[model samples]
Target chain A: MPPTSEPSTSDTAQPTDADALQAEVTRLRELVGPDEAAYTSLKIELWAARDSAFGAEMAAGELRGQVKVLEGQLAQANRNRRWMVERIKAPLRRVKAILR
Target chain B: MARYSILTPVYDPPEDVLRACLESVARQTFQDWEHCLVDDASTQPHVARVLEEYAAKDRRFKVKRRAANGGIIAASQDALELATGEFVCLLDHDDLLTKDALFEVDLIASTDPSLDYCYSDEDYLSPDGKFINPFHKPDWSPERFRSQMYTGHFSVARRDLVIEVGGFRTGYEGSQDYDLVLRVTEKARSVRHVAKILYHWRMMPESVAQNAEAKPWAYEAGRRAVQDHCDRTGRRATVVDGVVPGVYRVQREIEGEPLVSVVIPTRGSSARVWGVERCFIVEAVRSLVERARYTNIEIIVVMDAPAPAGVIEKLERLAGDRLKIVWYDKPFNFSEKVNLGAAHASGELMLVLNDDIEVETPDFIETMIGLIQEGDVAMVGAKLLFADGRLQHAGHLYNHDPFHAYFGYPANHLGESSVLACQRETSGVTAACALVKMSIWNEVGGLTPELAANFNDVDLSLKIRAKGYRILWTPYAVLYHFESMTRIPTVNLDELKVMRERWATPLKNDPYHNPNFEPLRDDWVLRSR
Candidate 1:
């Protein structure tokens, strides 16, 4: 209020980078409020979004590893099944008692 | 018209038993037969009544009741004294003769005019007159006859031969008939067999031969008879102890130390390789070279295919001068592989072994060879065990399954612990380990290649049995086996199918792969127990 400066054509045409950044920060602060609780909640929301993205990739990798282990177990099960069938197919002993 | 004198010694036999015996004699095809019934002062009235009735009905039947109650041997001799026929046949009052009994004897005497003595095969009947078993006799030979007397023979011999041998001896009471037969055969110009079923031996609970109870006296008499015959014939006969029936020992000097060729057929696989574990062949051969009790030994390794280069190199490094390799570039056929190996052996005895086994005892070869040298033993098998220390095979039971087949069981365990340990004579041993005389092997024609991988041992055992030789499974000889360790990764369906088919078909056809094994009937196992 001490001295009001007229707006320059360059400043009016496009906002400066530093001025834009500061304006966005002020807008966020106004929406959330200036209290410590609001500030802590805002920080937690940003951290949660980043953590969720990383957790999705890790979960997908773990699922792939489990799938590989399960496939190996299935192959082993089939081999054992075949071996059991073969053993059963062997002929049983024949016994003949002499007519005494 | 040749007259047949039937000498029957009667004790206090039941009326029914005596009637059956007389009826059987009456039914004989040869009508001109005379029966001498010597009664040993029967305490039972039924015996006299039956004998009197039979004597009155038939003119050919004669009765002689003893004044004193003499034993069976004296009564039998009394009957023999009354015999007036050219040929005499010994028959017990409790036993019976088949309808064609006399006809069979007449046929044999007429054909073999020079034959002075003859015997026939017999069948056993229960007291209730039910047929039990047929005791088939092999063709007659002097060596076979002297080695073992299988048939009681309801025999027909020239009267002079019986009299010259002093009929039946008193000392040989229970086995008097055996003693007399041995003496008659010795004195005879010719001895023969009818090879026909002409007699029915009734089995009574108290009968010496029929009863399973101990008859040490009878066995001793039989042993004496064998010894006396040998002494008379100037043949050195040593009673073979620790052997089963149908086995004998003959004294003969070793002509020369015969070289023994050991043949081992192997596939480089870990399962069938004879000495893969603890390097069996390598170690066994090394031991044989280092501590052999016998001087002459040769080791031959027959590979179905070239082993892995590493295995071959190791074997070559261990073989030294005693080992020979015969590469067989062919499919896996155990019998054929053995035959191929035998064809190349330069020894009198062939020792066959499996790849996955190792000889645990050093005296194994010597023990088997020594037994074979005693004569009569055709083949010897080592006791085989599994890696887990259970019996894999001791010997085989012939006709174990009624299908004329044999099987090995309880692999890698102690044989003496098996239920069949009581059976001393085995049908055959697993080809995995066996020592066989090359002479007998050649005479019997080695293993049947048609059997291929399975049951080849049974076929070989049967062939040896057919030659009147015994198959012995020695427990003293031991070997360790790792069974089926190198089996193919996949099951061979075709081989399996063929194995079963071959097993079933031969059993159906032969019904007795080993004639020594009595065919399975319901009563056999029960009676034995």
Candidate 2:
């Protein structure tokens, strides 16, 4: 509500280097704010991509373990083939013998 | 005038083959049947003589001759006119029926008095009379039937139903049986499958049993028959030739663009895929954003608390407004995370995907959306391939234990019945890349939390099936599943016990799989006997 005793700057003469330098700094700040934000966002995106690729690598390692388990199961199955065949064909052999 | 009438349209087959066919019918253990033979103006003189001898020998052998040369369809119609039995069994003139063929049919029909259609397994008979290549068929796969006529030989049907479908359409001469079966099943009250090899299709030089390509025109006829069936059944789909000759692909048309909620649960784990270290969730979202052809989808990522630093920022940057992040602070339970993500989704269809999956098919979402919209379908799963381009999951087989069908097979290898490439009903499909109807998901109570990781998808599948819903696996939608890359693949004893307790009967007897297949095997290999 009270009036100040300080004089207005617009009416003063303009020859100070500090004032020009300050004006230039204000202008540059306004111009570079969006570019800086964009650059930071792009960096985050790049990091995310790298993390995704790392996830895939981790997946490959896990796949190796799972594949090994499957190979073991397959080998066991092959080993039991003869036993299974004999067990399954016993009844058929009995029936054929009766018919003969 | 008989209990059963056997219809055989005779062409100029070899005299020995014709005599063998007649002898097989004459030696039937169930003797209350008549053989209706129609010679289609055979140019060879031996055909008539053989027919005359068979008719003279057995009073049950009814023979007729067409004055002009008519195709199989016309001959079959003439034979149909001569039938005066309650049921008709189709027999190729050169093929031989097992002695117990009619006996098995009679027994099955006696047990189920309301049976309208019946079929059995068959094999090819070599020139030296050795049986080989037995087609052990599933119980009653209606969807698989639409793909191909797996129930090819020894088809028995009620004579009234056969006559009602106008016998066989003239246009479908080569594939007349396929058309007839499709029409017959549409109105069938109960269809029974005799899981026995009752027919032996002779692999003659000109026979389809010798080589599928012997009659290429038959496949086109089959395609038209499928298309006509789709039209009659009010299915909005286009039938195209499948990877092989007799198989077909049904590309359904989506009614409207419905919103799809893709729920992915992850801990923001990192993996080395092709020597590149990357975040699994971020790459999964990136693939959806960059590769998918369908646009009406939202990405719901359920992330664990204390999330990896840059993963969330990257997902936001990639999916933008289409992304919704839900925090999971509890211990890692895949079922709970998926249920949490599903609870927050706002779409008609819920797509449960793993963090390591990369979309390979551009129209995978659209295809899944169309399939899940079917009235009887509860869920649909995608064909998954490993990082090395080997098959990871075609579907789940639960003959004894739950396992992936054709796991680690070549990516392009079609399974025993071309099942790996067709969209057909299955006992279960993996939740790694499955799209389910939102209402059906809620109805089945989602995945059972008790099954933290192992058998969760199998439990969900059984729950859905218990509600009389079908689970379909489609090869049309494909994805690269770098499985076990994030979470270690370990099975807990408690989870296995719970699954056994809940789904003991279905786990033991999977109707989608044939009994002749060896139990506890992923590949459809026959039993040792």
Give the whole-model CA lDDT for all candidates, comma-separated.
0.67, 0.89
lDDT of 2 at B210: 85
lDDT of 2 by residue, B1-529 (tens): 7979999999899899899999999999999999999999999999999999989988899999999988999999999999999999999999999999999999988888889999999999998879988999888888889888999999999999999989978998689999999999999998989889999999888677888899889889999999999999999999999999999998899989999999999999997765467589999999999999888889999999989887897899799999999999998899999999999999989999999988899999988877788899999999998776677889899989998988766667788778876788899999999999999999989999999988999999999999999998888899999875235567899998999899999998888888988888787877656
Clashing pairs counted in every model: 28, 23
The window of 10 residues in a row where model 1 chain B has the poorest summed lDDT is: B520-529
- Best candidate according to TM-score: 2
| Fraction of native Cα contacts reproduced by each candidate | 0.00, 0.04
How displaced is residue B20 in candidate 2, in Å? 1.1
Tell me the spans in candidate 2 whose CA falls farther than 4 Å from its real position.
A1-100, B485-488
Tens digits of per-residue lDDT, candidate 1, B58-88, equal 8788899998888989999999888899899
C-alpha TM-score for every candidate:
0.57, 0.86
